[model samples]
Target: MKIKHLTRALILGALLSITGAMSSCEKQTQTQAQAQDGQYVKKGEGALSNVMLATIQSAAYTPTLPTKATIIESPSNVLSPRTENDNQNQINAAITNLSNSGGGTVLLGSGIFRIKSPIILKSNVRLKGGGQDVSIIKRDESWTNVEGRGMLESGGYIEDLTISDLSIDGNRPESYRMSNQFPLFGIEITIDNGGTTRNNRVYITNVKIVNTGMGCHIKHTNNVILKGNYIVGNGTLASSTHSLPTFFHNVYLRSIDKAWVYGTNYFKDSPGGNGLNITHLTNLTVEDNIMTGNNFRGIRLGGSSSIILVRGNTVSSNTDFGIGLAYDETGQPQNFSIIDNTVNNNDNNGIYIPNNTKNGEVQGNSLSGNSPLNIKKGTNLTNVSCQAN
Candidate 1:
């Protein structure tokens, strides 16, 4: 009986020893993780406020403009779908007249309008549609010379313009299926500062853009807001024309500053191109966006961008990285913060920052299902803290 009791006590002692060892190991591991937190510096100091202030200072300030006055009605006297000639001239003429008379709304009532020529938007002009579902701006096949250019083009220091509640179909399947050489862009805003005008305060909202060579090309512009818009690159059409898919982008921006893009859906059917491609930007905020099913990175930042805050975004189901931060041809990205984002199911890393990147913070992100690595970093990556869930 004494032998049996001694053996039971020995077993209990061994179990206690094992438990104590596990507890000590756990405490040691936690201390190491806590110590690592102090290694990197946090970025995005006053980033949100700075972006907002810059937008307020530079934007066209059209809050007091009347909602329903001085209108240029569409079906545009001479340019309806049933008309024999394309309505490009009529549309431009109306826009020119409105701009000359200060500024007003060009109301697209209903139905699809075939635009054979580029619609150049002028200062303080608002191009509004009845609704996204009703008003369609389709590319005109009859205009062969203008095939690869943007259907609606803004340039020459244009400002105080708003494009809202419209659907632009690039007709990629019909246009590119037979010919891979066609250059198609949905909306392109180019800033030429040589003129006295500065392309500032451009507001785009509730716009549905699909099946284009690229969705919206915003280059060399400032104080731009792209909100509540649907920018899609349907893989079916892109795959139909094999070569074009390689160059497609849902929304591409270059040399833009004080831009706010939020509440937007970038729906890519296949791994075709990036959902948002930004380069050489400043004071940019991308929040509350849904980017999924993209072939490339969902959001890419490069070319020496600063004060960029990417927060509360769902970047998932992409064929490549969910968020890609790297160096461009000119320079490296800096002063960025990626926080509170849900990144998942990407083919590569959920968030990829090459060691060459500088001055960024990656914190409070819920990441999973990224193959190989959830967060892939490069050398010389500084001031960045990645707290994994």
Candidate 2:
């Protein structure tokens, strides 16, 4: 019958050419997961110059966040001159005599304690110190750039606070800004009427914050727990001079609802902003942290943040964008979970999921030479369910 119908039309044209090449490779992987619009490729933008970007544009403090978190609502700590010494009047009279004889623990000894101010804290209290390199709290080279809030500072709506070990030396930043406060951090939990106030169960352990402008600013905190701490924040003599650059940070959570930055060690990085700049957060959990060499961005979950979880981190060589779901002070930006990270060689773009970021989940990351390891500008109505990154 005509050679058996020419062998059934050559096996139906090789099964319709393998179903149109597997549906054109699933529509070219959903158009490369939304990457278009010139695929956001600008490789690198580091080693800031231009006089370090004009000392970060001579800080008109244009929204690189931070500093709405004021202190001095007077739960304690605000004896102004930034806390006039005698080690801040014997640690604010031992944390107001163990929080009015209700709470306890204020033991702090073992050398150097020349504080220039801020050691006020209350609510349950428990500011133990001894060895995080022998309890040193230096900071009083005639305290310049000193406004107030941190070197250990606090305000209203307090909770069961606990700051252990200790080794703060925020000997930097604020090289200016006075009257309108904001320029100081080394554990500054806030309040003083800048609105939003929660402040609950805060616990920071094995502390060791150095050269600071910011090394912890837990604002509007709630169930916060930054364990195994050891921030460097911005060194190199305040990032080669001024540019408190994008408002300093080695940790600057804001409007936080729940947090747990585990195994922290954002050391030797942050020439200024971001090494963990979290904002308007919710159920956050940044585990196994070790955010590396930053100049800006080594883990910055933006304002409209959602159920976030950046796991097994080691966001390397930051020059910006190693882990950024950034952009927003409100709305969009949802369930993120950049997993098994080791976002390597970041000169830029190891992970930069922007564009209406929705149900995100970039998996098993161990990306290499990140001038571009992943930059999914989400669509398909903000999917972002990528795999084996």
Candidate 3:
């Protein structure tokens, strides 16, 4: 009996030891699984990771304007001075000297200064004024031949300048009497020549441009913001013999890579003109603008391509179509969006998108006092919602 009791105690002890070993193995397996699942904390930060984080943070902020600016003030004379009779050379010399030194502001004091020749602007220069009503730059018709030569030329980086509160009158003899008689405007601002420097990152605000063959001309530029400016076509009263209709465009943009024209007012009493003429551009945004009584189309985008956004603009009393877009020779206008615009009282169709255009979205545009058809002859048009008001 004693031997049997001793054997039962030994068997119970062996069973208990086996159960304890199994529990220890299970705990070890759980710890190994957690390690395999990447549950460890990081010890040090990486250089590449920190750099990427810093780049993202910096990109979120708006860039600040340049610190130094040059001021160009007009001679103190209430009456307009002729380019030949007045100290025109002195003024041009001052402008050239300041721009060559570095980019700074050129202040125009209160007066009317008649400019016979086009004034050139170097890189990083700002032409400012005391007040829009106080300062004026009038063009002499005799010097109109220099229209395309550019009133301001930029060599290096041109950015962050306010050009407003001044009037540019283009009714002088040198400006008006042209042999070619083409649609040439008063001021030409351009950025070209494959320079590393970008051109015309300028803010044109609250200026009145009157009697100009074309008010403001921009070419080969980027990030040009035009706001709160009044652009009017030259009236027929300027010409007596020809009886030719007034040919003026409030703003003409040609071959610009990326541009925006917003919150501007354009009006023309005579016919055969455009409010805004855009040609050969990409990534253009036109919004919150008013175009009225234009003889030609309100906004004409000629042979442009890639990501054109026209939104929240008002087109009224235009003799031709309100908005017109044409494909380039290569048929390249792929993506265009026209949304939330009020187009009324146009003689022709409200919106005309030709068959050559592809991948367009026309939505939430209102049409009134004209034909019911807002869109015409376009393929691959999706999500288009047009309603008559």
Find the candidate with the highest lDDT and give its number. 1
Please give, for residues 131-206, the per-residue lDDT of candidate 1 as tens digits. Answer: 7878888877666664447878884667778888889887665545334355577888886665234467788889
Error (Å) of candidate 3 at residue 280 is 2.1
lDDT of 2: 0.65
Arranged by TM-score with the best first, the candidates are: 1, 3, 2
Q: Is candidate 1 or candidate 2 better by TM-score?
A: 1
The window of 10 residues in a row where model 2 has the poorest summed lDDT is 49-58
> What are the per-residue Cα lDDT tens digits for candidate 3 across 101-125?
6545566777777666666655554
Q: Relative to the unseen true structure, what is the C-alpha lDDT of residue 60 in candidate 2, on a scale of 0 to 100?
A: 14
Q: How many Å off is the CA of 72 in candidate 1?
A: 13
> Backbone clash tally for model 1?
4
lDDT of 2 at 284: 80
Q: Could you give me the TM-score of model 2 versus the true structure?
A: 0.35
By summed lDDT, which 10 consecutive residues of candidate 1 come out lowest?
A: 53-62
Distance (Å) between predicted and true CA of 246, model 2? 22
Q: Which stretches of candidate 3 lie over 4 Å from their true place?
A: 1-88, 141-162, 172-184, 191-200, 234-248, 267-271, 371-374, 378-389
Q: Global lDDT of each model?
A: 0.68, 0.65, 0.57
In angstroms, give how far residue 26 of model 2 lies from its true place: 14
